[model samples]
Target: MNESAATITKPTPLLIELRGVTKIYGSGAAAMSALRGIDLHIDQGDFVAIMGPSGSGKSTCMNILGCLDTPTDGDFFFEGVEVGRMNRDKRALLRRHYLGFVFQGYNLLNRTSALENVELPLIYRGVPRAARRARAQAALAAVGLAGWENHTPGELSGGQQQRVAIARAIVTEPRVLLADEPTGNLDTARSREVMELITTFNREHDLTVLMVTHEPEMAAYAKRQVHFLDGLIVPGPNQGGDA
Candidate 1:
């Protein structure tokens, strides 16, 4: 099999889809467009990395995909549901129900124990206390953090903190995992560990992962890579067309 074939097999029915997604800031001639009519789809179990230089609009795309920001004009469908049309409360509900996020900084609360951090989402969803604790512990154990649950972020190393973050993000068994520069702050060894953890979850749990990164090495871990240039989607040197 070819190298590309060794990576992503083929596109199935997409869990994340975007059409004519545009984000414009400002007005008139001074109007700046962050994303310009981008069309993309990512199937279930696909691990995609979005790459671009600074100001290339990849970050904006990440925000839109994560439901943290709405597009200025366009249609976005998540798991066949029209998410772009939902109100703020509904959007929050959808995010809580179907999306998980990890970031460069591993934003675990300083005051909360790792276990509590993982349980926060379940609490927000009104999960019963006992069930929430059980699931949170299970998620942490999945990430190889079984004995570290009582530690706080300050007590863990960079890699450990990120594992806790990943544990928190996946505890809900979200439909999609959105990671923005997940290893930007880690050392090479730590970054590789984090990427491997993510890849394992993608392969074993069938989680759809969309990650944003500028590093080619990091992007290589994904099943497909999409490049952006000047606020538009451009074909990356390694991308296998619109698969």
Candidate 2:
């Protein structure tokens, strides 16, 4: 083969994957299946939005992806490492070093300054105080909150608080961002602003994004959408998030 042929690229592997994954709660007559041997794979730097109605299993899947829960059967792989084989501490380390999350409620401490809240994850990682403070400041600046870092959550507007939450999520330069209804609490204008910031990060940082949102407008920001129904991923466009 010529050198050019030798340089041809290979198909990229999945950044995250699930194979025949299942999750069942309780047992016997009281059992509830949250995922029924579902298979999914996500490429790095892709943004995917997950949508489903109540009891449709989207949240359960999100919990598993976030490492907050384990599948009852099958396997989950992250960067080709079988997550199911990892002990709790290893999983925690993976989450700490690679995953970032933003929630619908903005999940910030009511009395903490925005900068301090952004520094919380670093604190858990044992980052030195000075470095954490500097990184937190930089993250706030990236999210357009530079001058407002010292404001407490209660002192900030809903949009501002959510910005702080976004700042905190990205402060670690995490590889994947998991956002659940990130704009749920904001007005239309604020929601647009937040989405714009997220989109910029995905484009510029090449951050892989997995978002869960029932609102079609919010999900529209994603590159694609995955619909869930009866514990399995379904084909076609979203079914309007109705179970």
Candidate 3:
């Protein structure tokens, strides 16, 4: 066999990356820094937990990662594309196509059924009614809420509502799932159920996951945890303690 023929080269793109990231609110003396000169990387299919105390910039970082907010300084790359430099419309499009978000509040439509709420993203993307309905139903089933599709949030328990939210997030088949305190509103048993579902989705679908959690038990579900304090990453073993 020829040496040239045997040679193989391929590079895996990082699903998310931040370099020298900084976030500042206001300006001058009144300005408050959220994230300061931070560098972080997450590859495809990796589960990362971002843990930090209140006002430690973890939320800011999650916003930037989810394309919900732009950094005041430095670069943010998503799947080899520079998201920080993209215009607002481009950023919006990027988020619509590549990102899914699950929040502590389980931002589902209060008046809508679980299936309809799960279909909202697809509806925004101009997916036809039939296709969106089918996909939404499938997503609901994936989250173990097959029979709850017709129920509204008010009719479900906290865990069920969160399950609907997860179904909505995954219905789009996004490349990255940004979960901000996803289990924050659930009880211990419910939290375990939610985390197990998330873990299964991450492993079976090969989805990249980035979660922000103040609870150590919640963060333990992730493969690796990165701690933040006073706007910077806390290096060493101390990083694993309570946020």
TM-score leader: 1
Residue 127 of model 2, lDDT score:
93
Writing each residue's lDDT as its tens digit, candidate 1 over 74-171 gives 89998788887678898898889888999999999997899999999999999999999999999999999999989999999999999999999999
102-150: candidate 3 lDDT, tens digit per residue: 9999989998999999999998888999999999999999999999989
Candidate 1 lands at a TM-score of 0.93
State how far residue 243 of model 3 sits from its true place (Å). Answer: 16
Compose the digit string of candidate 2's lDDT tens values, residues 94-199: 8898889999999998899999999999999899999999999999999999999889999999999989999999998887889988998899999999998999
Candidate 1: pairs in clash: none
TM-score of each: 0.93, 0.91, 0.92
lDDT of each: 0.89, 0.86, 0.87
TM-score of 2: 0.91
Candidate 2: misplaced stretches above 4 Å?
1-13, 238-243
